[model samples]
Target: MESHERIQAACDFLLQSPPGEINDVLNDVRNIISDDELLQEGIVPALKRYNLAQFITVDVPETNHQSIISEAARLSTGSEDEESQERWLDPRSKKSFVFDHIALEASDPQPFEPNEDFETFRVALEKASLNYLLAHFHDGVSSAFSNQTTPNQFILQVVANKYNPTNFWSGRWRSEYIVDLNDHTIKGTILVNVHYYEQGNVQLSTTHSISIALPPAIVTASPESAGTKILALIETEEGKYQNSLNDTYHEMSEKTFKSLRRALPMTRSKLDWEKVLGYKLGAELSSSKGAFTSGFS
Candidate 1:
């Protein structure tokens, strides 16, 4: 069948079928297309037309905490490269440390365009994934200490508070697409990991991973409303993390995680898939223009 015809058939099936038969109807659409690439391109838009984007599987499967820590450490110490380090001295400890922050984002500019195809979606997903990795290294000097020291004092406060035992901290933000076109569902994940150090040793680590299921209707819905719903889901996940950690850690980890939550931004901007899709391949994509803001100071 022609691509448009197949899409129309899928839409017609969805419109007439009951909720319980969604899976069967989706499977039939896959069978009719019989091409992974073509199905990914054509059927997805059809699903969106029918308000079924949520059923797509978009996610970031690999989130390596150890890698995040190692990259943050490398950036902080400037061992990997001196130019990458942003040095600062702690006021209380009088010790120099590096503060690095990274953000990862992915987008597609014309995801909803009639001519949008699997290649466009695949490119967007690949770009987002690369950003997820590069986010670990795209460090910037923290604003909190940017103006603290002059040529005379030469010392900058590292930790947010004087009483805190941690002398250094680093944070990374990541967002990616894990699209399973074969399954007829779309999904995404947002990750935030923060590490605290004292005397160059990690004292505490806190992480938040948010899984988002985008409904097909989202493609046609208001971007603002869609973003708000996604952020709400993220906040809900944050609450779950707090509850899960409540009984596990009664002291430092608990206290530090709570403080980190307060420091992080709770709101996010609307995601522009079209712009994200237009990014260059293998480039260090910046999330500053994406939905969420950097939570680390």
Candidate 2:
């Protein structure tokens, strides 16, 4: 079947059984357009809608993580313009976040133990990354997180579905690194993606990739020593995005949202909150009693 048709069918399947497990839903998409390059184009939105709105996270298959690396490989090879790359590569666009490149270089590449060395490096980095991610992105709220380490890259994703029983707010975070394993030296990019949904109140989402340069001897360093440096790297990037989220959230809640709940400005200027609330509340409440008391009582 065609890609759009498959996507539509997947959407229909979701609407029919919205509570289907994330893996199951993704598997269904995988069956349909598994060969198409636009695999994420269909699966991502379907998964986002289904996972963000309907269900808490489940065991996301390791294939899901590897697919990201595969996508990175595709993006690197494709000759598409930067804009197209961003549109397809970005997990979300609500915040217009962009990705930065990460390049790992080596002065003297050496042949080392293959799988074992990669595994050691991957485990050390993942262990440190998960800890930092929880500290920075999670804000102490309990979230479902996954870190996948491969010979080529590492991916860490976090999903938070709990809200004030309203199901109005949902969020997910993902970070991935795509690396080129060249004997001893490696090269690649690391990216962080965040998506937040607030029904009626806000929807703030973006995936920004920041460029990071890996140490030349990263693959050769001792696991402990490598982890320490990688920990510092994760700390730097996660810290940057943490600040971005904070600032954007403030802008959204403090400025952009006023139009949704506050009185319209008639003179093309900001509305006087004091006067608007006073007049609106005064007309509805007995001025002799506190508005809260009168309304609740």
Question: Number of the top candidate by TM-score?
Answer: 2
lDDT of 1 by residue, 149-230 (tens): 1211111101111122243554433333333323423344433434455455443334444444556664334434433443
If scored against the real structure, what TM-score would every candidate get?
0.25, 0.45
Poorest lDDT segment (10 consecutive residues) of candidate 2: 87-96
Residues 125-194, candidate 2: write the lDDT tens digits.
5566556646665432112111133444543333323233255343444444443334333222333222
- Candidate 1 residues lying further than 4 Å off, grouped into runs, are 1-166, 175-192, 203-212, 215-220, 242-248, 251-297
- The alpha-carbon deviation from the true structure for residue 239 of candidate 1, after best TM-score superposition, in angstroms, is 4.4
Error of 2 at 227 (Å): 1.9
